[model samples]
Target: MADEIKPAAQQQVQIPVDVSNRETVYANFVQAHLNADEVYLELGQFSQVVTPTGPDPIVLSHRVIMNFVTAKRLADLLRRAVSQHEQMFGVVEVDPNRRLRVQQPPV
Candidate 1:
């Protein structure tokens, strides 16, 4: 008699994660380039110029490349996390005008 194969949901798979020499990076700016199968992410920090003439310079700190599946998973996780944060505290807006007003002198 042959044994029946169990479905993926019924089977338990243990995935190991190694973080022995993990590098941590702090990025205020993230740029994502996506293709048909993969996603390229550039993580960096933006330095504000003394004069508000042009855009700030972005210094790339790290780059992460992942498949579409992993990228989608990460997006879902970030969405859930941000939603929870907003619920706990308040909504976070990325309005440049708000920061500009603080930096600029009274007119």
Candidate 2:
């Protein structure tokens, strides 16, 4: 059987986007909360404080709520972007100690 071809308009879509007043935020820390319907992403800045007692506490500053489907799409997109970035530059290490080692020049 011959394969059918879709019309140009049906095959492709062009979406018009306006970002004149869009806000940009930078987050060093992120926490995820998932429910049955949606996912909550708490974005924040993390700072390490040296105390005489125990480990430092993380404080959250901002949050963004998205649906499960959107969260999944974001995850997939981020994964692909990170993979491509690692291929072009280098792997991004999350651990502080490991990151220091990875950044050191080879002998």
Candidate 3:
């Protein structure tokens, strides 16, 4: 069998994320393509996420809308990297009444 042809059962996963101000974050990735060359990824762009806390503010997230695109494999790698990170440490928790917040310019 030639490498050009992939099994029909092989599914190209797609990872999409919806960054919101819920103060909670979750992510998933979909692999669109796989090859030997450079990997590619398609990261969703977020307009803004601002969750204000109480008196003091500390945490902040600044997201830049990346118009660029990446291949399916690269995207998958990125998704894994994020997963490993969370596992090693812990899930990033958003404090509703903490001393920090997430802010970004309107998209």
For each candidate, give its TM-score against the true structure.
0.76, 0.73, 0.25
Ranking by lDDT: 1, 2, 3
Task: Write model 2 residue lDDT over 1-107, tens digit each, in one string.
Answer: 99998766645668999999898877888989888998999987766676789657777877889998888899999999999999999888888888777355789
Worst 10 residues of 3 by lDDT: 58-67
Residue 61, model 1, lDDT: 86
Per-residue lDDT of model 3, residues 1-107, tens digit only: 65696567967899988767446433232223334654433323343345574333323242222223444455588789988998998665546455255555689
Best by TM-score: 1
TM-score sort, best first? 1, 2, 3
lDDT of each: 0.86, 0.84, 0.49
RMSD of each: 5.4, 4.5, 16.9
Model 2 misses residue 48 by how many Å? 2.9
Top of the candidates by lDDT: 1
Q: Could you give candidate 1's per-residue lDDT for residues 48-106 as a string of tens digits?
A: 66556787778998989999899989999999999999999877667987745645567
Better of 2 and 3 by TM-score: 2
